[model samples]
Target: MRIVVARCQVDYAGRLTAHLPMATRVIMVKADGSVLVHSDGGSYKPLNWMSPPCTLREGATDDGQVEWTVTSTASGKGPGDTLRILLEEVHSDSRHELGVDPGLQKDGVEKHLQALLADHPATLADGLTLVRREFPTAIGPVDLMCRDAAGASVAVEIKRRGEIDGVEQLTRYLELLNRDPALTRLGPVRGIFAAQEIKPQARVLATDRGIACAVVDYDALRGIDDVEDRLF
Candidate 1:
């Protein structure tokens, strides 16, 4: 990861035009070749960003200022959405060698819930059985691919604390999955947003989308798994 604090001007050309005038801000170049321009505030979300599968070219601007050009290909913000940054004055530029992280290692929040749900999917809904976990999709992996007793496909998104964003993610997955002729052959694939606690607004949004919102019982699910193991 490379972090640079510089007084820079940024211009993005894509579906829309966005510009950040010359000001001191942080530019984050992630390992995946994505670049984000962040101001000091705005929480964690970047002011402007280009996702991975992009390329970065460094050169000098007309005025001899350092310039970074980032271009993204075919991840569908159109064929190319370009971010051009002109660094007028770099306050501090530091490159840190953060050796490949093994990824998130939390026990109780998102991942743990995903694992437990995958192991015991019926807990999400009666008669629901797991087809697979990390189900492949062009966009990314679905947390759980399942089928109800009637054999209709179900795409389940599991989150520790369900919010509007989680529902939005599941909605996109369903949109993709339903387009697959093979999956749709059985029946229309549906979506379930499963989480430990879902916000009220999220529930309303999910219900509106025809996606079911399920509240997970962490301890009860663990107990059910233990009991099923004992029975075997």
Candidate 2:
């Protein structure tokens, strides 16, 4: 990962147009060539970003100031998408090579739920078959992805306690996944927010957004002894 703190102006042109006027912000260039521009706040969400599989070109402007151009590798026409950063001054630039991440360690409840669900994905819904775990997306990975008997794609988000935020997160993942070209062909992708307990309001919100809320039984699922079946 490479981090640069610089006074810059950013302009993005793609599905939409956005501009970040002159300010000192953090520019992150991940190992996969994804670029993110961040201000002092807004949690983990960046002000603007160009996802991986893109090209970055570095050069100077007419005034001899630094400039960086990032273009997307999407399937659209000339320059799928673009992020242009014009730098007035660069404060710091550092690079750290993080080979590969081992991934996250889920909480106790979430861990058992995911494991049991992965082993028995049909428990979520009838005719559901496990496709893969931790399916990747542009923003992050979904907890699990499965397919129904009709061949439609189902993105599952597992939470120990399903709150409104969990529902919102699942909504975002479903939105991103539906746009993926590779997954789009598999039919419409839907979301299922599964948790040991779901807030009533969260269920309403999820239903309003066309996302299904499933109350999972972590302990009951864990009780399913796979060893007992073959031992006989």
Candidate 3:
């Protein structure tokens, strides 16, 4: 991972246009070729980022100032999406070798949800049956892998509360899963973002990516909401 602290201006061009005026901020170039721009605030979320499967090139502007161009590799009809970062002054630049992450350890609720969903895959979708739990992938393990009635592979990601980052994570898994011929034998691998509550923005992003979102009911799945057990 390469981290750079600089006074820079950022501009993005693609499906939309955005600009970040000159300011001191942190720019991160991940090992997977993703680039992220972050300020001191915004909690953990980066102000702007390019996901992996992209490329970044370091160059100089016409005036000889340092600049970096990050482009998406998924271009189809038109030019690929591009993020241009113009650096005015570099405060610090360094790289580090962070070994492979162990990945998130699901909390009790999320862990239980995965187990419940695995037993009741039909709740997510009719005729969905569990294939394996913690299906291995190059990056990490998928929460649950299932197959639909039509024999299509489905990768389900379980989250306590769904957010944009969760959706992005599932998107990456889907991308990697689809590449496996065994998983894509019937058709392209599908993705399901399952959580007790899914944020509006997360749902929108999942939909835009052709992934399905499922809102799971914890109580219902646990049988607490069962009519026979309820005392009205």
Candidate 4:
């Protein structure tokens, strides 16, 4: 799946709601040969050609880069079935920028991480089930958190394309979880820092701590015909 932010404009409120700014336009394309438009509001509006609403699994934005995932809602399609997208857009904030919301970038990352856990439950090697999740920790919520069968817990921190400082953040979560009794019982607690690419430090830290870390390239998760078709 691909999310293309065609154009963006600032929305400002005036005396009443009548002076609202124009809604930005974004084009989202899927690998299953489908497309949709994520406007300022409303559902994932399907592109005229596709004739269906693909389930949005994840989204993210950072430094004007936008990315997201969508899946066919059709039955028999597993959660692993999804499409990933990335696009660059101009940012001006002058009501003339052709870009997507930076918030969407973070959203995309969280969604992708969730999809991974949902799609590859076996990879978790048992004793794990996803619970609550959020992103941009400074904004008040951490990226991903799950409970293990042993009553232990795990937290996953996500990093986008250019955010190279994920190791430190992940380490903090691991440390915090290890110290918190509610989460410690899940000990030998571990953290998973997922991204399109792994920084050297992140790789080294995970290896040293014996934490389970993974890097998922967008290209690698695409073009699965059986997965796409089954999703719909």
lDDT (C-alpha) at residue 135 in model 1:
97
Question: How many angstroms is residue 196 displaced in model 3 relative to the true structure, after the best TM-score fit?
Answer: 0.2
How many clashes does each candidate structure show, in the order listed?
Answer: 0, 0, 0, 13
- TM-score, one value per model: 0.52, 0.52, 0.52, 0.41
lDDT of 3 by residue, 1-232 (tens): 9999999999999888899999999999999988999999989999888887788889998899999999888646236588999999999999999999999875447889999999999999999999999999999999999999999999999999999999999999999999999999999999999999999999999999999999998888887687566686
The lDDT values for all models are 0.90, 0.89, 0.93, 0.54
lDDT for each residue of candidate 2 in 22-107, tens digit (9 for 90 to 100): 99999999988899999999999999999878999999888898899999886663574899999998999999988879998765
List candidate 3 stretches off by more than 4 Å. 1-108, 227-232
lDDT of 4 by residue, 1-232 (tens): 4555554322212222211123346664555446554556666553222224455544566554555454556566554444444433533322233455456344346567557555553344466677666632433355777666776666766665424366666776676657667656546566666676776766877767666666654433533334445645
Which sections of candidate 2 miss by over 4 Å? 77-80, 109-195, 198-232
Q: For model 1, how does the per-residue alpha-carbon lDDT over 6-67 read when each residue is reduced to its tens digit?
A: 99999999889999988999999988888999999989998999888898999997778899
Q: Is candidate 2 or candidate 3 better by lDDT?
A: 3
Structure candidate 1, residue pairs in collision: none
lDDT of 1 at 120: 89
Q: Name the lDDT value of residue 106 in candidate 3.
A: 56
* lDDT value, candidate 2, whole model: 0.89
